[model samples]
Target: MPIATIILAAGASTRLGGQPKQLLTHNGKTLIRQIADAALSLQSGPVIAILGSNYEQIQPELADLPLQVVLNPNWPEGMASSLKFGLKALIDEPVDAFLVVLTDQPYVTTDLLQELITTQQQTGRGIVACRYGEAGHLGVPALFDIRYGSEFMQLSGDIGARKLIKQYAGDCAEIPFPLAAIDLDTWQDVEAWSKRQGAGFEDQGTQPKS
Candidate 1:
């Protein structure tokens, strides 16, 4: 099945003192590029990276990648705005399912995403979501069958794809992704994550555009 993936890089990164987590360097590429490349690596279908806040600066990171770039003017409204916009862009495309990706999840890999797709195909489930492997947390990088396209558009506020995963739990399959629990939401988070990886990061004083 052709699967379209959306990389959510639209956040203002408020917790990181106005830094754009999407632009943060990981290994060699920016977090956004890493995640975008992971999606593209699948060669499944179109990949979309939603930008907002510091979109002007973030856009170039994804310019060379073969994926759709969407800027969310209402990104401040939260994840829901970006989610809805990305979903709208592909809801009518020839895709069997949608996989929502997050830039902050440093460990999300192509294999992991494939696992979600594989599980969905094997179980014949409509949704395939990740379990943080902690407290049974179910969230994105989640996959939703095209049947949930309308629900994706109706999301509002900061709520994201996780809401749909929870709402339709019975129809969902779970993949154990303890690494999904490690997200870069704050300066401390970045510091801790980098330190754990034997790397260091200096807050570059990057300001948000939104």
Candidate 2:
């Protein structure tokens, strides 16, 4: 099955004092590039990126990568807006299913994405989401069959793929990914994560984006 991918990188990073998380360095490459590479690593379909906020600066970081870039002018509206645009871009493509990804998740691996695809194919479910802790918040790095494309288009405001995951829970399959719970949303988050990995990020400044 041909699986397409959308990497959501349009957030303004308000929580990080205006620094674009997508440009943050990890494993020698920008976060955006890392996630984009992971998506394309699947080699199953086209990878599209939704860019907003500091797109000019962030674009260069991904200039050498192979993926479609779509600008979300309504990015201020929130995550759902970017998702809607990305889904619209893929509506005409030839794909069996599409995966929605986030750029700030440094731990999201190509392996996890492949698992989502594998589970979807094996279970024949339209949606395959990562199952985390007790809150049971199903989220991206998720794969959605083309059949549910319309539901994605209906999303609005700050909502994201999670909304649809819950709306159609009966048809979804879960993959345990506690690592998905670790996301870089704030300076403290980065600090804590960096310490956990002992990545020598202690001197990287405390201003979140710095």
Worst 10 residues of 1 by lDDT: 201-210
Q: Which parts of model 2 have CA positions greater than 4 angstroms off?
A: 201-210
Candidate 2, backbone clash total: 0
Worst 10 residues of 2 by lDDT: 200-209
Candidate 1 residues lying further than 4 Å off, grouped into runs, are 202-210
What TM-score does each of the candidates earn? 0.94, 0.94
TM-score of 1: 0.94
How well is each residue in 62-161 modelled by candidate 1, as lDDT tens digits? 8887789998999989899998888888956899888999999999999999999999989999999999856879998999998898887888898888
Each prediction's whole-model lDDT (CA): 0.86, 0.86
Give the per-residue lDDT of model 2 (tens digit) for 1-210.
789999999999888888887877755677888899899899999999999999898888777877889989999999989988898898779998899999888889899899999998899999999987578688887999988888878878999898898999999998989888888888888788888988843212324434
Which residue pairs overlap in candidate 1's backbone? none
